[model samples]
Target chain A: MKPIFLLRLLVIAGFIGFVEALCRIGIIDNFTMPPPSRIAADLARALASGKFNGPIRATLLNAALAFCLAVTVGITAAVVIHRLAALRTSLDPFFATYYAVPVLAFYPLLIILFGLGSAPKVIIAFMLGVVAVIVNTLNGLDRVPRVLLKSARMARMGWFATATQITLPSAAPFVLTGVKFAVAYALIGIIGSEFIMSTDGIGFEIAFAYNNFDNATMYPLIVLVMIISIIVNMLLSIWEKQLLERRGLR
Target chain B: MSLTRIEILGPILVSVALLAIWQCAYWLIGDIALRSPGQTVRFAGELLSRPTFWPHLVETAKAFVAALAIASLLGLTIGLLLGLGKTAGDVFEPMLIALYSIPKVTLYPILLLSFGLGLSAKIAFGALHGFIPVALFTMNAARNVRPIFLKTGRVMKLSRWDVVRKIVFPAALPEIFTGLRVGFSLTMIGTVLGEMFASQRGLGYLLMNAIGLHHVDVIMAVTLMLVLFAAVISFALLAIDRHLHKRF
Candidate 1:
C-alpha cells in the first residue's frame, strides 16, 4: 500500500518534471505557459514574501463561514423535509437538478438583495453547497434502519438519547461524505463569485492578474488555488476516514 | 415512478407559491431590474419575439450538445479501458481524483490561450467539466460489475466482447447513465462559464453583456432560460432513467 502511494507521487513528480523540461526546451511555449519550476519558485516566493497570506486567509475564512452556514441550514431543511412528506415530495425533484443550474445566475440577484462585499459571495458558496448537504443528510437519516428505531423505543431510549447515541452516529459517515462535497462546492462557489466580482481574496487575485495580462502572477495564483483545493480535499477526506473508522463503517 | 395526482400537484403548487413570493419581493424591492414573475414572463415573451435571442440560444445549445457528445464519447471509452483493467484503474484513479479536485474553471485561461476565444474553447471547456464526473462514474460502475456475471459468461465460453456486452454493460448502464446526467449538468455550467469569462456569442455572453449594460431584465431573462432548459433536460433524463431501470 505504501509503495503504491510512493509510486503515485513519483509518477506525478515525473510528469511535472517532464513538463518543466519541455517548457524550458521551448517544446511548449514558455511565454504563455510558465515552466513548472518557475511556478514552484513563484509559489515559494509568494509564500515567503507573505503576499498571498491575506487573500488565502480571507478566502479560507469566508469558505469556512459558508460551510458552517450550509451545514446548519442544510441539515435543518433536510430534517424538516424528512419529517414532512409533502415538502419532500415537492422539493426532491428540484434538489435532483440543483447542480445543473448555473447557480451563479442568481448571484446578481443576491448582490442586489444581500448587499455587496463578501456577503453575496458567502451566500453564493452557501447556496452552492447547501443542497448536497441537505440531500446527503436526508439519505443518511433514511438509512438509519427502522429496526434500530423500534429497538430504541423498546429499550425505552428517549427521543433525545436515541437521536444522540444511535441516529447521529449511524448517520455520521454519510453526513461526513456530504461535508467533503460541501467543502469543495463551497470553495468553488466562493472562488467563482470572486471571479465574477470582488476586490480581494484568491479569486480576485487570479482575475486581477489575468485582466492585467500578468501571466507570471496569474500562473502562481492558479497553482495556489489548485493547492488550496487539494489541501482542503485531503483534510476533509482524512476527517471522513476518521469518522467512518470510529463508527465502524469502514 | 408513477405519480399520484397529489404528488403531481405538489410541485406545481410549490412553483406557483414561489412565483407569488417572487412577485411580492419585486413589490418590496420596487426595482425594474428585478421584475415580478409576470413581468419576467412578458420580458421572455418580448425577447423571444426578437431575432437576436434565437442565435444566442442556438450558440449556447450547439456548444452544450457538442461538449456533451465529446465528453460522453471520451469519458466512456477511457472509463471502460480503465475499469476493465484493475492495474490501470489502480494507477490512474488517484491522479484522476487529484485532477478532478482542482476546479476546471481555473484552467480556462490556458484553454483560452490554446483554443482561443472561439466555439472550440467553449466546447473544450465544457467537455473538461463533463468528462471527470462521467469518467469517474463509468469507471466505478464498470469496476463494480458483479464477478459472478463475468464468471458465468466465461464459463459459457463467451468472447470478450460478448462478456462485456452481455454481462458488464447492462449491469453498469444505470450508474453510467447517472454520470451522463451529471456530465450534462457540468457541461451546461462549463459552457456558461466559458461564455461569461470570454466569448462572442451564447446566452452566457449575452448575460455578461447585460451585466455590463445593467440590463437586469435581460440577465434575469437569460437566467430563466437556462433554468428552464435545465428543468426540461432533467425531467427528460428522469423519464429515461426510469425506463432504463424497468427495462434492464
Candidate 2:
C-alpha cells in the first residue's frame, strides 16, 4: 500500500513536471494552458485577492441547499417507495435511465419558470442529485436485516421509530455513499448550469474569464473548483469508510 | 403479475404517468414557460420534417460517433494496460475516481483552448467525459478474471497475447460491454454539452439558440427529442447489459 501511494505521488509529480517542461519550452503555448506551478500561484492569488468571494459563496450556498434538499427528499421518497412494491417496481426504469437523460436540457425551461436566478440552478442540482440518493437509499433499505424490522415490530415500535432507530442506522453507510454522489452531482449541476447560462457564480466567472481569453483567471478558477470538489469527495470517502468499518460491514 | 411481466409493464405505465404529470404541469404553468406533451410531440414532428434541422442532427451524430469511438478505443487500451499491470492499476485507480467526480464542465474551456472551437474540441470533451468509466469498469473486469483460467493458459504454454485473447478477453467482454453502454450515453451528453457551450451547429446549439430567442417551441421540441433518444438507447443497452451479466 505504501509503495503504491509513493508510485501514485511520483506519477502525478512526473506528469506535472512534464507539463511544466512543455510550457517552459513553448510547446504548450500560454494561450492554451499555464504550467501547474503558475496555476497554483494564480489560485492562491485569486483566493487571497478575495475578488471571487461572492461567486464562491453563492455557488457553495446553492450547492449546500441542493444537497440538503436532495438528501431529505430523496430519503423520504425512497422510504415511501420501499413500502410500496408496485410503485417501486414501476419507478425502477426511470431511476435506471435518469442520469442518462441530460437534465441540463431543461435548464432553459427552469430559468423561464423560476426566472434567471439561483432558484433554477438549485432546482437543476436537486433534480440531478435526488435520483442518485433515492436509488442508493433504496438499495440500503433493501439490505436492512429483516430480523431488525421484525424485532422492532415485536417490540411494538412505531414506523417512524423503527425507521429512525433501526433502519436508518443500519443503512447509514449506504446513505453516506449516496450523500457522496449527491455532493458531486450537486456541484456538477450547479456549475454546469451556471456555465451554460448565468450572470454570476464560480462557473459563470470561469465562462466569463474564458470568453475574454483571461487564462490567468480562468485556469485558477477551474483549478479551485477541482480542488474544492476533490477535497470534499475525499473527506466524505473517509467518513464513509469509517462508518462501514464501525458497522463491521467493510 | 410475475416479476418479468412487471418489468415489461412497469416502464409503459411509468411513461404514461410521466406524460400525465407533464400535462398537469403544463396546465398549471400555462403557455408562458412550457409546452404540453401534445404540443412538444407536434413540434418535434415538425422539427423532424424540417430540412434545416438535418444538418444540425448530422453534425451532432458525427461528433457523437467520433467521440464514442475515441473513448471506447482509448479507454479499452488504457484499461487493458492498467488491468494487466497490478502496480500501475493500484497507482491510478483512485486518481481516476477523483477525476470522475470533478465538475468536468470546468475543464471545457481548457479543451476549447487547446483544440479550438470546432468538432475536435467537442469530440475531445465528449471523449473526456466517457473515457474514465469505461476504463474503470474494464480494469475491474479484467483484474477479476478467474486466476484458474490464467493458470490453465500458462500450463498450456500459451504466450501472453494468446493468454489474454483466449482467456481474459471473453471473461471481461460482458463488463467491457457494460462500460461501453455507459460510455455511449456520457459521450452523447458531452458532445451535446460541448455544442451547447460553444458551437455553430447541433441540437445543443439549437437548444441554446432557442433559449436565447425565448422560443419555447424549439426548446421543448429539442429537449423532448434528446431525452427520448437518451432514454431509449439507455434502456436498450441496459437490457443487453443485464442479459450479458446473466449469461456470464
Candidate 3:
C-alpha cells in the first residue's frame, strides 16, 4: 500500500483504540457501551459455541436466494419493458411510487401471506431488491446507441443475437450497480423481516439479546454485522472497478 | 398519439388486470389471510375513522420531522467539513461507508436500551438512518466543487466564510437536495422500524397490532396509507430538488 494509505489505516486504528481505551477506563461505561476488547471476547465466545454460525448461514442464504430471484425477475421484466417505449413511460410512475414506499411497511401483510418464516423474509428481500434492478437495467439498455442497434439489424443480426451480443454486455455495468444496491437492500430487508417475525436469524438473535438485556452479546453482533457489510461492500467495489476498467468506462 | 398512447396504456392496463386477478383470487380464497382489495379499502376506512388513527399518524409524523431536521443540520455540517479537507475525507470516508452499509435496524436494541423504548429511540433511529446519506452526499458535492472558483476567490482576497457562503454553499445545494431526498426516505424507514420494535403508538405499532389480531384487511389498509404518505412526501421533495437545481 502507499504510505498515505497505510497512514490513513493507522489513523483509523488509533481512533478505535482510543475509544476502546476510554471505555476500559470507565470514561464510557461498559453496561451501555462495551469496549472493543470485550466485544472481541464476546465474538470469540459466540463463534466457538457455534451460536453465531446458524444465524449467519440462514441470513446469508435468505439474502442470496432473494437476490437471485429479484435479479432474474427484474432483468427479464426490464428487457420486455425496454422493447416497448410507451410501456416504459406509463409504468415509470408506478416504479417511482414503489421505490419510495418502504416495502417494510408491507411486512405485516407479507407475514399474513407467507407466515413467520424464512419464506416471508425472502419475499421481503425480493420485493426490496427487484425494482431497483429493473429500473437500472431498463435505463442502461435504453441508453444503447440507436445506430448500434440499426447497424446490427442491417447486418442481419436476429433479435436474440442483437440482445445477447450488443445490449446485455453494454448494460452489464449498470446492472452490476443495481446489484450492488440490491445486495445492501437484501441484507436490510431480510434483517428487517427477521426482526419483525422470524424463528431463526441474526435479527432474531439480536432481538433475543435485547429482550434479555444481554448488552455484551448485542454489541458484538452489531459489530459483526457492520464488519460483514464493510467486507461485502469492499468486494463489490473491487468487482465494479475491474468490470468498468474492462469496459474502458473507468 | 396512436402508438405512443398504447405504449403508455399497455403497462397500466396490464397492472390493472393483474390487480383484478389478485382481487379475484383473494375473493375465491375467502380467508382472513387473503384480503380482497375491496375489503382492505373498507377496513382501512373504518380504521381511519377511529380516534386512535390520528394520534398514531401524528406521532409518526412528528418523529419523522424532528429526525429529518436534526439529520439535515448535522449531516450538512459534517459533510461540508469533510469535503473541505482532503485528509478528513480520506480518513472518514471508509468509516462512513461502513456504517452506511450496516443494516441499521440491528442497532434498535441498543438504541432502545439507551433511550428506553420511547420517542427518543425512534428519533435516534431516524437520525442514524438519515445522517449517513446526507453526510456522504454533501461530502461528495463539496469535493466536486470546481477548484477554479476557489482559486479565483482566493486571488481576489475573499475570506473563508465568504468563499463558503457564496461559492461553496450555492454550488452544493442541488447535491445537498439529492442527499435530503434520500435522507428523508431513510428517516421514514428508521422511524417506522424503531416504532415497530418498541413504541406504543405510531403506524408501525398499529400495523403490528393488526397483524397480531389477524386483521389482515386493516394491515393492508394501513400499508396502503403508508405508501400514499411516502409517495406524497417524495413528490414534494422532487419539486424542491427541481427548484434548487434550477436556482443553483
Candidate 4:
C-alpha cells in the first residue's frame, strides 16, 4: 500500500482504539455502547461457530435473485416503452407514482399476497430495485444520440438490430448506475423484510440480539453488515471506473 | 389545447385508468387482504375522523422535522470541514461511503438498544441516513469550485471566509440543494422505519398494528397517507431546488 493509504488506515485504527479505550475506562458504558474489542470478540465467536453463514447466504441469495429479476423486467419494459413514444408519455405518471411511493409501506399487503416466506422478501427487494432500474434505463435510452439513430435508420437497420447495436451500448453505463442503486435498495429491502418478519437472516439475528440485550453481539452484527455493504460498494465503484475508462467518458 | 396541457392531461388519464384497474382487481380478489379504491378511501375518511389519527400524524411529522433540523446542522458542519480540506476529505470519504452503503435497517437494533424506542432513536437513525449524502455532495461541490474564481478572489485580497461566502457558496448551492433533497427523503424513510421497528405510536406502528390485526383497509389507509406525505415533501423540496438552482 501507498504511504497515504497506510496513514489513512492508521487514522481509522486510532479512532477505533480511542473509542475502545474510552469504554474500558468507564467513560462510556458498554451497556449503552459496547467497545470495538467486545464487538470484535463477539464477531470472532460468531465466525468460529459458523453462526452467520446461513443468514448471509439467505440474504445474498434473495438480493441476487431480486436484482436479476428487476433488471430483466426493467430493461425489457424500458426497451418496449422507448419504442413507443406515446406509450412512454402516457406511462409517465404511473412511473412517477411508483417511484415516489415507499414500497415498504406495502409490506403488509405483500406479506398477505405472497405469504411469510422468502417470496415476500424477494418481491420486496424486486419492488425496491425495479423502479430505479426502469427509470434509469429509460433515461439512458433517451440519451442515445439522435445522429446515431438517424445513421442507423439510414442504413436500414431493423428496430431490434438498431437497439442491440446502438441503444444498448449507449445505455449500458446508465443502466449500470441503475443497477448499483438497485443493489443497495435490494439489500435494504431484503434485510428490512427479514427484520420485520423473517425467522432467519442477519436482520433476524440483530433483532434477536436486541431483544436479548446482547449489545456485544448486536454491535458486531451491525458492523459486519456495514463492512459487507462497504466492500460491495467499493467493488461496484471499481467496476464503474473500469467501464468508464473503456468508454473514454470519465 | 396546448401541448403542455395535453402532456398534463395524458398522465392524469393514465393514473385514473391504473386506479380503475386496481379497484377492479381488488374487487375480484374480495378479501381483507385486498381493498378496493372505494374501501380505501372510506377507510382514510374514517381515519381522518378518529381522534388518534391526528396525534399519530403529528408525532411522526414532529419526529421527521426534528430529524431534518438536526441532520442539516450537523451535516452542514461536517460537510464544510471535509470540503475545506482535501486531506480531511480523502481520509473520510471512504468511511462515509462505507457507512452510506450499509443497510441501516440492521442498525435499528443497536439504535433501539442504545436510545430506546423513542424519538431520540428515530432522530438519530434519520440523521445517520441523511448525513452521508449531504457530506458527500458538499465535499464534491466544494472541491469542484472553479480555480479561476478562487484565484480572482485571492488576487482581490478577499479573506478565506469572503471567498467561501461570495463565490464557493453560490457555486455549490445547486449540488447542496440536490443533496438536501436526497437527504430529506432518506431522513423521512429512516424515521418511519425506526418507528416501525419499535415505537409505541406513529403511522408505522399503527400500520404494523393494523397488519397484525388483519385490518387491511386500515393498512391501506395508512399507506395512502404515507404516499401523500412523501409526495408533498418531495414536491416542496423540488420547488426549493428549482428556485435555488435558478437563483444561484
Candidate 5:
C-alpha cells in the first residue's frame, strides 16, 4: 500500500513537472496555460486577495443547498415509491434513462420561470442529483432483509420506528453512495449552470476571465474548483468506505 | 393490467402524463416564456423542415460520432492496460474517479485555448467528458475476469494477443459494452455543451442562439428534439445492455 501510494505521488508530481517544463519552454505557451508553479502562486494570491470570496461562498452555499434538497427529497420520494408497487414498476424506465437525458437543456426554461438568479442553478443541481439518490435509496430499501422487518414487528415497532431503527441503519451505506453522487452532481449542476448563463459564481468568473484573455485568473479558478471538488469527493469516499466496513458490507 | 402489459404501457403513460403537466404549465405561464406541448411539436416539425436546421443537426451528429469513436477506442486501450497492472489500476482508479466527478464544463476554457473554437475543440471536450467513464468501467470489467480462464490460456501456451482475443476480450465485452453505452450518452452531452459554449453551429448552438434571441418557440423545439433523440437512443442501448448482463 505504501509503495503504491508513493508511486501515485510520483506520477502526479512527474506530470506536473512535465507540464511545468512545457510552459517554461514555450511548448504549451503562456497564453494557453501557465506552469504549475505559476498557477500555485496565482491561487495563493487569489485566495489572499479576497476578491473571489463572494463567488466561492455563493457557489459552495448553493451546492450545499442543492445537495441537502436532493438527499431529503430523493429519500422521501424513494420511500414513498418503494411502498407503491405499481408506481415503482411504472417509474422503472424513467429511472433507468433519467441520467441520459440532458437535464441542463432545461436550464433556459428554468431561467425563464425563476429569473436569472441562483434559484435556477439550485433547481438544476437538485434535478440532476435527486434521481441518483432516489434510485440508490430505493435499491437499498429493496435489499433490506425481510427477517429484520419481521423482528421489528415482533418487537411492536411502528413503521417509522422500524425504519429509523432497522431499515435506515441497514441501508446507510447505499444511501451514502447516493449522497456521494449527489455531491458531484450538485457541484456539476451549479457550476455548469453558472458557466452557461449567470452573472456570478466561480464558473462565471472563469468564463469572464477567459473572454478577456485573463489566463491568470481563469487558470487559478479552474485549479481552485478542481481542488475543492477532489477534496470533497475524497472525504466522502473515505466516509463511505468506513461506513461499509462498519457494516461488514465492503 | 398484467406485468408485461404494464411494462409496455408504463413509459407511454408517463410520457402522456408529463406532456399534460407541460401543457398545464404553458396555460399557466401563457406564452411569454412557455410553449404548449402541441405547439412545441408543431414548431419542431416546422424547424425540421427548414433547410437551415439540417446543417446544425449534421454538424452536431458529426462531432458526436467523432468524439464517441475516439473516447471508446482510447478509453478501452488505457483501461485494458491499467487493468492488466494490479498496482497501477489500484493507484489510478481513484484519480480517474476524481476526474470523473469534477465539473468538467469548467475546463472548457482550457480546451478552447488549446483546440480553438472549432469542431476539434468540440470533439475534444466531448471526448474528455466521455473518456473517463468508459475507462473506469472497462478497467473494472477487465480486472474482474476470472483468473482460471487466463490460467488455462497460459497452460495452453497461447500467444498474448490470442489469449486476449479468445478469453479476456470476450469475457470483458459485455461490461465494456455497458461502458460504451454510457460513454455514448455523455459524448452527446459534451459535444452539445461544447457547441453551446464555443461553436457557431450545431443543435446546442441553435439552443443558445434561440435563448439569446428570446425565440421561445425555437428553444422549445430544439430542446424537444434533443430530449426525444436522447431518450430513444438510451432506451435502445439500455435494452441491449440488459440483454448482455442477463446473458452473461
Candidate 6:
C-alpha cells in the first residue's frame, strides 16, 4: 500500500475508533454522536436504495453550469480590468468585500426576477464563484513581471498578441488556482442555496431527511456530499498540476 | 491632489453609473416585486424607526458576537493542541482539513435538529462555520513556526511557557488573525443562514418573514441592512489586520 494512503486511512480509522469508544462509554449519545460504523452502513444502504441519484445529478449540473459561467465572465473581466487601470481601481473595493456579504440573502430578490426555479440557484452559484475568480485572476495578471511585458513590447507585438502569448502563459498558475478556488466556492454556493431554498439537489435531500428526523439517512447524505466534493477538488488540483507541468515542457 | 481626487472619484463614478442602470432597469421592468434604489433606500430609512427593528437587530448582533467568541475559544484550543503535538497534527490535520473542505452549512441541519429552532442553534451553527477555518489556520501558524525563533528562545534560557508566550505566539499572530477574519465572515454567514432556515427572531428571521409575506419593501430593507452590516464589520476587521501587520 502507498504509505501516504495508509497514513490517511489510519488517521480516519483512528477518528472513527475514538467516536465509537465515546459512544460505548456513554460519553456521547447515539442521537448526537452516531457511530461511524453505523453511519458507513447507512451510506451503503442509502446508495443501494438509489435515493440520491436525482439530487446528485441536479447539483452537479447546476454547479458545473454556474462554474463555467463564472469562469468565462471572471476571466474576461480580469483581462479587461488588467488592461484598464480606471476600471480596476473603480471595482477593486467591491470585489475585496464581496465574500463578506451574505450573498444568499439576496435570494428572495433573485426569486422575483427568475421565479422559484433553478435559475436563482444558478445566479447565486455564479456570483459566489465569479467574485473569487475575478479577484484572483486580476491579482495574478498584475503579478506578471514587467520585464517580460517590456520584452514583448520590444518585439513589436500587438497588445493582444503580447497578452495572449506572454502574459497569459506566465499567469496560468495563478489563474488555475483561482479556477480551483472558484470550483470550491461554486459547490458551496450551490449546496448552501439548495439547503436554504431549493426544490431539488443533495442539499434538498439533506433538508428532507432532517425534517423527517431520519438521522441515519441525513448523516450519510452529508458524508456523501463531502466525499463527492473532495473527489472533485482532488481531480481539479491534479488537472492544474498536469497543465502547469505541460507548460514547463513547452 | 488631483490624482488622489481622480482615484477617489473612480469608484464613486462607477457606483453612480451602476445605480443609474439599476434605475433604468426598474423603469423598464415595471415589476412591483422589484423596487427602485430610491424606494428601497427610503424604506430602509423607515425601517430604522420601526419598533420591531431594534429587537431583531439586537438579537442578530448578540448571536454574531457570541458565536465569534465561542469559535475563537474552541478553535484556539484545538489548533494549539494539534499544532504543538507532532503525532496529533499528523493524525488529526487530515480530518480537520477534510471537514473544512466540505460546505459546513450542510451540517447545520444536525445542529438545528439537536438544538431546535432557537438562539443556541444559531450560535452553534455559526460557531461550526467559523471554527474549522480558525482551527486549520491556527494549526498551520503554530506548526510552521520558525526553528530559529525557538532556538533564540533557548539561547536566552527561557522557560517553556515563556518561549511559547514570547516567541511562538507573535510569530503565529498574523496567520491567527487571518483565520479570525475568515472565521468571522463564516460566522456571519452561518448565523444569518441559521436564522433564515428556522428561527423565531433575528435579522435573518425578519428577512425570511418578509419573504413569506411577500413584503418586498421589508425584504429589500432588511437585506440592505444585512449587506451594510457585513461591510462595516469587514472594514473594521481589515483595519485591525492592517494595524497588526504594522505592529508585527
Top of the candidates by DockQ: 2
| iRMS values for every prediction | 1.7, 1.2, 2.5, 2.3, 1.0, 2.1
Q: What is the C-alpha lDDT profile of model 1 across A8-119, one tens digit per residue?
A: 7888899999989999899888657889989889888888999889998998899999999999888777766887898888887788778888887777666655655899
Query: Tens digit of lDDT per residue, candidate 3, span A5-99?
Result: 78778987898899898988998776677888888999888878997899999999999999899988998889888998777787876776566
Top lDDT hit: 2
List per-model TM-scores for chain B: 0.92, 0.96, 0.88, 0.90, 0.96, 0.89
Q: lDDT per residue, candidate 1, B13-96, as tens digits? A: 889988989888898887855888777788988999999789998899899999999999988877888899887788788767
Model 2 residue A14 CA deviation in Å: 0.8
- Tens-place lDDT per residue, model 6, B1-248, is 13476568887898799889978988987657778889989999998898878899899999999999999989988887888777777777767766666777788877876787788999998898889888998889989999899888899999987876897778999889988988888889889988887688998888778766778888888888888888888878876877787787
Better of 3 and 5 by lDDT: 5
Worst 10 residues of 3 chain A by lDDT: A92-101
Model 5, docking class = medium
Pairs with backbone N, CA or C atoms under 3 Å apart (clashes), candidate 2: none
Off by over 4 Å in 4: A1-4, A90-100, A145-157, B1-3, B155-158, B246-248
Model 5 chain B: ten consecutive residues of lowest lDDT: B1-10
lDDT of 2 by residue, A1-250 (tens): 7888898889999999999999999999988999889999999998999999999999999999999999999999988999989888889988988888988888887877888999999999999899999999999999999999999999999999998899988888999899999999999999999998999899999999999999999999998999899999999999999999998988
C-alpha lDDT of residue B76 in model 2: 93
lDDT of 4 by residue, A70-131 (tens): 98998888999888877788777566545445677778777777678889888988988888
Clashing residue pairs found in predicted model 4: none
What TM-score should be assigned to candidate 2? 0.98
TM-score to true structure, per model: 0.93, 0.98, 0.92, 0.92, 0.98, 0.90
* Candidate 6 CAPRI level: medium
